[model samples]
Target: MKKANTHLVLNCIIAEESITIEDVVKKTKLSRPTVVNIIKELTEKNIVFKSGFAEYTGGRLPTLLSLNANSYFAIGIDFEYPPIRMAISNLKGEVVLSQGITVDRSFSRNRIIEEMFEALERMIGESGIPMEQFIGIGIGLLGYLKANQGISLEILRIPEWKDVDFKKLVKERFGLPVYMQNDIHMMALAEKRLFLTDRADDFAYVGIRPGIRAGIGLAMHINGSFYGGVHGNAHLLGHMTIDINGEPCPCGSKGCLELMAGEPHVVARYKALLGDDPDAESIRGIRDIHARSLGGEAAASRILDEVGSYLGIGIANVVKLFGLTTVVIGGPDGELYYGLLRDHLKKNIFKNMSGELDIIVGRLEEEMYPLGSCFLVIDQYFKEPTLDL
Candidate 1:
């Protein structure tokens, strides 16, 4: 309980750049002596520093405290898909150094882990940050994960990753605590901390990764907590059947949204529409489609409209089910297609729903995954002690 109080007090101070003991006591509802003692301990550890004196009321001025942002560090990695990304972050959630390595199916699971370890080691060595400052490692991946047990039950795209004890492996190899979560869930966590801290707590994050084989993935924030249902696969919204008899998905479902609006499918639809055009051969991916749409190509625009309509249907179902007022679209493909899809998505959602909804396209860009993974570690500092990492 004392440790928990200390954490809470530290979080209060961190949240407010410069705060007094009275402020922390008020925010945490802890007794004044407890807040003072915790602040003293933190100051002794150099984790919290005396910034300056607060305003002088009638009596003496109280000392203001602030977090020492560089006192600790964490490492985060996103290994779900190609171009594995990793970063080292400070206590303030600022990325000090980040790097990426591309991989293909040819790289076995063991090989991927080995390469990841090497890259992380090289990064730490180059950054000149002391290893002792790092609290733990956080990893975000694509799959059904038993995050509490640090085991990945199944990864849709990587068949070889079945039943792997990722938490134990990482912890044993690095001699540090490890936290694991689904990629989309991690992104939602990041969104909560970085972008939506002042917004609604009940929102949904929908991500579309093009090459992962798995369709769209979703993570929900309910009542200020990330709700991963039993089996850690709740809200597989991508697999939702938008078309009853449209196309077969690997999940054995017909007319799933992933197959209908995912990047690869959208690209294929564009190519098919081009049908024997000499320029059709140049259309390789969604980016090309986006470019053509920007160039006012009628076929490309029509294909994007269709994709957006399908995505809107999926998002509408999510909004109706969760009664969510905000839906944030993210992921590599999502970033590229968001602008093209926003209006159609909004129109379909408004047509289906009764109230106003805030549809936001994520702006985290390339830092989305790694930074989210980093928060997987940073979040430990703010959660209640009884909560599992």
Candidate 2:
């Protein structure tokens, strides 16, 4: 059974990143005996271990009960759209194994799930990692879901998805705990980890994909915690209505952000102008073409620029209202995303608001969503490490 004291110490570990037993006692304000007991139990459970010795305080060197990075591993399952993906990460957030299985419009999900499980087992077998070391599997569905209830609500448009209690079904079938969340929120987890606390706290991440969703993250230095926003739907930026009357969205909104900044809309809007070049149905493909053409193609460049302009309009509003110092754009196409958006956002914020703006893409661009799923699980267990943007 998990004790309250152990939970406190663990929270401290998650909060401070690393600390000594004495530091844990000082921070937690728990009696030395209680701290010691909890530490002992944690070490015995192989959850925590003496990583190293603390600084010389001119006395006996104290031992540190840092989290065991090898203590457990987590599975992050993110759909890369054209290619559904999965990854295995350790407690330290290292990718141990990865695989992707594509599911097209003609594909049957029942067969896809079977293929996914087979691929997962193959990866596990190849990695030589013990099944017991796996803490759980974190899944990122590219749509709305009552994750706790294991119900998906479209965007990815899985056939027969309505009847699937994903979390319950996956857990029961695999005999391992499975946690699911909306992809955008999960990607925000990766964004939070990639940016240090100083730059990341209280920032929001918005991504444009086949759909539009944003994850609002609050770095609570007050208590060393964060809120992913009520059911992790806080940053529904696209639904915020920049234009009261523009385009009709499936969510019953007219002129939503998704229609303006999302991948499908971005490509279709430009494809309408370009006519005969490529059929970009996925964010990944559009991004590839956008990156290639950012150098020469005037038409493609304008599309990227326009998407950035729309993003700037939406993001600038978030900065002015949220007082957010930083806003991250994580999508397949940066050629169109942050560049134009940053240019216009700076202009708007300075003209209307008073705060420094720092907009840059985080580290996990290609694997953003998958890492986001892994990020959710690892973050709950670790401090959700981040890289400087």
Which prediction has the highest TM-score against the true structure?
1
lDDT of 1 by residue, 1-389 (tens): 88788878988888899998888888999999888888888888889999999998968788899999888888988876666888998888888999888776787888877888888889889989887888899988777778788898876677687899988988888898898888878777777777887988898898777663645889999998888886567788888999998888877889998888877777777888888889887777777887888999999888888887888778877887778888888876666667766676667655655457877776556665788888889887556687443
**Cα RMSDs, all models:** 2.7, 5.7
List model 2 lDDT by residue over 1-389, tens digit each.
23456667887876676789888999989999888888888889898878888788787887766777778888888854446788888776778777777665566767767777787788778889888888788887765567666666555356455546678767876677777776666766766666544664566666655432222122221123344445544456767676787888767889877677666666667767767655444334456547657669787787777767777777777777767776666656544466667777887786545346667675556554566677677755544334444
Candidate 1, overall lDDT? 0.81
What's the residue-level lDDT of 55 in candidate 1? 93
- Model 1 / residue 207 / CA error / Å: 1.7
Residue 292's C-alpha lDDT in candidate 2?
51
**Per-prediction TM-score to the true structure, in the order listed:** 0.91, 0.81
TM-score of 2: 0.81
